[model samples]
Target: MLTLACSWLGMQWVHEAGHVLGALATGGEVERVVLHPLSISRTDLRTNPRPLVVTWAGPAFGVLAPLILWGMARGFSLDSAYLFRFFAGFCCLANGAYIGLGSFDAVGDCGELLRNGAAMGELWLFGALSSASGLILWNGQGRHFGLGNNGQPVPFRHCAGLAAITVGLISAGNLFFGTG
Candidate 1:
């Protein structure tokens, strides 16, 4: 449980950091980033008016970060490469699961897309893409559905735990904050 909570915390950082990076990259100035159990928040101070692109950036970064790490790990020596590989798979699973689950409600990254006038098809497609990519990466790690030779599928529990905690907390946040 502690591991799951810590990992949940770390993934939230990565998720929000993605938003900060996206805002910065898109020529927006990010004032601050805050991570709560319910959601990762970013204050973009840029008045430049690039809302759609900036909004998409956070989830894009979440999906891409692990893939980037995995790709870069290919260049490392054999022994050291495993660490990056583990993290890559972990990030992919965590982020993908988080997005897939969170999208079921009228809030979160997917909600941001819809509120910005994105079609339902677009939302579903993005969810499928991210989740599929994560599954593919997980397959490579031999841990899909806990069928790996090592018999340790508990890692997926972390993914599910993230999703559960996110949904519960975000729902609570919405109740308290009134779904701005």
Candidate 2:
């Protein structure tokens, strides 16, 4: 489950990074960012000029950043490109599901989206497109995780090392971002 852990943490970080970028783009001041491993991630803005853009940025960039990274990995012919691809797919699925599914429950960012003029149909469309893209990207990815011999295998040690490093970086970064 090391890989899953890393992917989860990385996804949260990237999603929040998107919000940070949006805030920066809109001249919003980030008052605090909560990204603890054990807590739900959120970005609190002190001065948000454009709430809709900031809210949308969280998931939009969350999915795009990893896709870009995966593209770069594939372009460079990295043997670990599958891992990056998997991460990208996972982000799309998670973020899409979070927003799409959240529409039904009317909570979290989706709630905020709706409150700020986002149509449920728009949320559904985003969810469907992103999750479908994730699934399409994940096709034929089984072999990378020691599944059928259809692709290059990723070593367990590398995954473990990645997990460790990810935890370290996120934990350290939180010191600067937590509750401020």
TM-score quality measure for candidate 1: 0.63
The TM-score values for the models, in the order shown, are: 0.63, 0.92
Give per-residue CA lDDT, model 1, range 121-176, as digits (tens).
66667667777765665565544234457644545555665567566655654564
Q: After superposition, how far is residue 15 of candidate 1 from its true place, in Å?
A: 2.2
Instruction: Tell me the whole-model lDDT of each prediction, alpha carbons only.
Output: 0.60, 0.88
lDDT of 1: 0.60
Which stretches of candidate 2 lie above 4 Å from their native place? 149-153
Model 2 Cα shift for residue 85 (angstroms): 0.3
RMSD list, candidates in order: 7.6, 1.8
